[model samples]
Target: MLERIREGSQGPLAMTIVGLIIISFAVTGVGSYLGSSTSEAAAVVNGEDITVQEVEVAYQNQRARMEQQFGEQIASAFANETYLANFKSQVLEQLISEKLVEQKANEMGLRVSDEQIKEAIFDIDAFKIAGQFDNDTFKAILQRQGFTAVSFRDYMRQQMTTEQLSTALTASSFSLEDEVAEVLKLQQQKRDAQTLEVNAADFAGDIELSDEEINDYYQANLSNFDTQEEVKLAYVSLSVEDLMANESVTEEEARQNYQDNIAAYQTIEERRVSHILIEFGDDEAAAESKAEAVLAMVNEADADFATIAAAESADIVSAEEGGDLDYIVKGDWSESFEEAVFGLEKVGDTTGLVKTEFGFHIIKLTDLKPQVTTPFEEVQEELTALLLKDKATDTFFSLQEEIASAAFESPDSLEEVSNISGRPIIQTAFFSSGNYPASVNYPQVENVAFSSELIDDKVNSDILQVNDEKILVVRVAEHKPQRTLALEEVKASITTQLSAEKTQQAALDWTEALKQKLLNGESVYDTLAAKSLEWNEVSGIERFASSLPSEMTKSIFSLAPAAGQDVDVVSLANGNVGLVKLTAVEAVDEIKAEDIEATLQGLANNNSRQSYDSFVAALVDEATIERITR
Candidate 1:
């Protein structure tokens, strides 16, 4: 069912195991199928219509997800029309890719049975409660993820079918022993090198920039000097928790409500049973006959069930304990076995041979707690709290509707909303898109505050969910549009930047002249004396060693040791230059067997991923995809 779909392969071909269930937070309720003819196609893949409604649904889901994770950085991007269009376009492209895969799978005759889909659903951990599958929990979780039972099943079948296709595409990669040993040797290799340093700041004192240069550079890059547009929001924040204190359930109402749903508050009886299991192997009839013989022996007048179980039961772990299985509820065991267990009248009562996947089981009722209905006096307070919570939730939703309507109708300000909902208008200090006030810390509030509807149009925003219990509606109270900073305000920083650029260029030019001298085999000890540069020699450093600058290390390693002594100039990260000289390279002759195997597996996985990418690329090229703007 839900096999380890991405067990080793690492590429788009590995799609994702979540794709197996479409356990989606980014795409709401998108199944692999077309809608009715009246539905409009946003794109067509192999003549299959991906409806405009599907794209919009997936887009909203993705947008909500993006706003939650990346709001601080990309909050302003959402206000840009081009960014919104591109975001929606990405959603459409993903749908088109999925459609192509579905078409290809259909052409290949790949399929998943309904029974397989059921098994997969039952196996999902999200759908389980107390380590057992609960139908209500399954349905609730599915509803939250935007799926009906039928649609999820269809989606599962499509995903599992595609999984089968994905597995086939990368199933053929392998590694040779020699290639693995060679890789292991290289991984153990170390290199020795030396670098002559040239610091840019050391040359800065000799360079100077004029005001004319600074002004010219600033004039050409005005956009870089523009301030980020900011806003102050006037909003009403409401919470269900704030309304809970006002809600109360009377004793009589609690009592009557408890009476109506008493079954829900009662604990289920659990049966603790033990069984002597007889496993069916090559001869099923023989095993069944043996199971019946064991059952007869346990039923004898003077027989000890424990003694017989320990002597003959095929279930080794339970057999050692005289077949003592712990407490179990109705769904814990298979249907045929459950029926036999539940049918037993009392403790010490034994059942006839029960046929199951494990074979036959002679089950004996060890103990049970009878189902108990909790008295109203004992649970009266709990029931009252629940009733009050229900009342509060209902009142909260009603108040939320009032706020939403008033906020939308009275777009100029939150005064109408404050009057209707009785929540006072809150003002936030001026905050940029990323930095926000504690009262309105939610991404939804931040996004709406920066949105055009609230800022440009000066209209109230749609009610935004701060959390399950809280919501916010906002409009920009003050708007500050982006403006270029004057040259006087930014003159000193521009001068410093231009000075650093000149110094860095000087360092590069100096390194090149030294590199040519080193290449001609002139001794570096004497060369350093002439220009005040010295070598930072490091001995036996590995390829990835951090003792030297990373750029210098990489340049040093790139040199072929077989090519004899070499020199290369490197641009260091800290505004400096590096003239690296490779001295020697060493590779260990021995590596452990486990290290070899691990290296081999890693290389093979890389090869497999590349192969899978090629396969998908080929399929994508073969497919005919049309992008429709309308």
Candidate 2:
């Protein structure tokens, strides 16, 4: 029963266990296992034991995730001996880290209060409505996730506590204003640069290869020349789409169904209304006086509503339309406005001053539409088409299973099955392992085609159920094996690569020579121009860092700007080299007041988190962790 309950929901078991542990800790001032006896201590940090049952629960929860994502076949492979070893190592590391962090949190006396937990929960958007916390919504969400209110709140509380612990440990790591200014300057800077690309084609014509060498290379790689075994497949798919196309429903039935469930399709009566809004300033007396003046003019007819709206209405959007608002359905407008609009009995009828969340408004109803029920006769054709399609789909899949069974037993051809089932058999040309044909998007069809048995020998697959109304059967007519390329077929390509390598070496040597000349008191621009190489400069380059392109920005910024000193050469992963020198350094622009406040808050949060992480790391280092794997 418990297994069934757990399986019915997609929520992770680890989260549930963590929530339970937190609740236990909160209630008893120490953690204890509540679910089962499998909870034995797994590790210890400064006499604080990490339970074995807790680790197992976490592991199972993670394994379930792997199973859900990759399916049973791949999940089994991942759970095997080799993969399990790696998984164990990762699990142990995480456990150790958590223990270390917890121990540090204890040493620092970091704690979370009930009031803080309640505040955090209320602040979470998921539990709020209309800018306020809604207990019903929170309970509904917990129920949907198979969690009790207590369990859900415990989970939230634990997360908040963990955050608190982190903040305590890392609060001191934040930098001063000068450091932040320097960082900001680097972030906002930009570089204007140009590159001189030396093409491989420039050296391609200079390289030559001998026939003898080519022949020797081909002889050493004969397997590369062998043709891969390619396969053609013959298969049949059945889907409800064909059945649905053929089925039909009568007019009488359509009308009856519509009458029986009129509320399901009936739209609410709505009105197209518009209004002239008069917004009040912060001063209550002034706002009231303005409202009274606008109301008196509207009531006296001295000024027409549309003309007055155009001249003085604060809601410019509706005022420009002569206070014309489009048709609005129930719940579309604010409560007071909606009530006033719906209360009108005739078009062009104006309402008394109405107050809503937006402001004061004098509304005029322009148009009205009464709710109407659609007649069954009017929708008969649609109903008929839907019924026909559903019938055709049922017939299609019913015939599919019979055809698949016959084809699988015969092992000779799909012709017999096609004739018996009266369904057309389609054929595919040679396809590679990773290639997915447009028709193979159906999971059942693709799975059958990729099966080892079907690929190895010409065999028909069993009827595969894709959905309730769809089934497929496939047979392999050909097989293909991947092969390498022979040297003779690729010799020209190799020669081109070799030539490009030599050209790159020559360019590097030239660059080096220019560097030495600069070091010997020669102007970099003059030395480069002497060799017909042009020099370019990039200014205000940002101090960006990334591993991609092999840290080009870092290398560029690392260069010194001392006069007569050659910039250190930096190599790129793409076989390019560059030399850079800093031109100038400047502080960041003045920070805005709001921006300064935001920065301070962000810095404080980051510092807290860092401290917490360091504390955790320390605890993990001092702890004894053991793993008993099955």
Candidate 3:
């Protein structure tokens, strides 16, 4: 498995980092670690250090992936600590596996050639189109990832080498026909089962509790029983929405800005062309000679482009469509082929043999359209609205800071800030301590508003930063202390609690009774039905358990049911009781006659690898690893 590390602030890139970290184990040899100091490394395995720089790169890659998947959501909570820690651990495991694979490959003398690296790099789907590598497209992707041409090539080479090693390791390890047949047998197996539920509510009438006992329980758990303190406050918030409603931008400014950046408004002419590619033979002289002869045949004939394409073109899809490629804008095709096609004027015109990375192509212009630009009057309103929104955002934040500063120094209530600033004070009604009040739009603001210091002491909260610029300060208007309930007030609650306890014990007793009936050779299904419960059969369940609607599947799987034997009553995770009867036994099949030799060899290789991994892990465990956290 490959190891990866995650890093970055909340964004698309951050999410990508988190996902890549999760899947890093599959890649092998790469690991991620988090460290703040330059000298500190996240982890070291077998004397190979996982550096901070490597972690950062992996993190960025993960973030980019997240951005692509979730768009705006990637920016919200990508930097959450729980997420980052999990990502780090996963990436670290992957890195360790990658290093182990690399070490094994080296020991086995496995190496990648220059030609192999070149082919792998050129063949990447992100860098290619229509069977050819596009340099501009390749460069653009690398630029977005902050990688240079040389660095990308190196990265590709390492990936190719690692993949070659993994293929060698897993090539021989595969299930034999007999093994598959046995697995299939298990898949086809079925089971008959029954379940009984002991409802706790059924025994509620039998339980009894004294008033003194109930009072003591309530007092011991006062925090749970007492009413939570709640409050209402009034405040005004300055937001871009408020300012944008009143702000306006002049048409003259919009027009001038558009004219000043005229290049952004200009449109470029575009065309679409498609051609058949016949790759040259390995013999240089023969291939060139064949290409030239084919070019001459098409030129000499007065045949239509579609006729020539159908008869000679190697690209089956486009050739069938008479080389129809549909319309393309700028940066869509190879520079040489695009330049030639765009240079043509009249319809039915064709170019001479054009050689690109894919092969030689005989191009014919399909369609062409002249560039068009929108007039200033048509776009002025849109531009002015956008400009005014930007201006409002700036002005709103400036006013927010001034208001917050004044409120902090005066030591007054929320009303004082609202009154002095002439902004209306908003109030939230009494709310449970942990629950958010209905009036607040920002949960973080509400959280601070109800904090112990702000509520009980009646002090202004620390400036709360929302997004990049918006700030808020909150002060409590009223405080209510939590109090314990009297025994008379909580008697009904104690009665309900005692009743629930009794019902739970009764359910357990009922399940045990059903188990006894099964042991005495009575039909479990009949007993379950008699007790007002239901019996179900879940067939073809795999040994690797998953969710099941019937409680019997959970009970049966947990007991490791043996053929013709009954399991005693089992309680489920959610407090349901069940019993299971084993109807069949299945075991993995041994190697078959045809696959015996191959399967044995594969098992030997896997055993060898497992031994090697265990040895390495032991060595790593013995080494001292000191960490200094920042």
Best by TM-score: 1
Which number leads on lDDT? 1
Each model's lDDT = 0.78, 0.62, 0.60
RMSD of 1: 9.8
* Candidate 3 local lDDT, 44-158, one digit each (tens): 6556666656665566666666676797445434544455667766666655565665565555555556665565556555567887898898677666555666655555445
Residue 132 lDDT in model 2? Answer: 90
Clashing pairs in 1: none
Better of 1 and 3 by lDDT: 1
Q: Residues 25-52, candidate 2, lDDT per residue (tens digit)? A: 3332122222344466666546656567
**Can you give the lDDT of residue 58 in candidate 3?**
62
Candidate 3 to truth, TM = 0.57
TM-score of 1: 0.63
Tell me model 2's lDDT, rounded to 2 decimals: 0.62
Q: Worst 10-residue stretch by lDDT in candidate 1?
A: 1-10
Clashes of each: 0, 28, 30
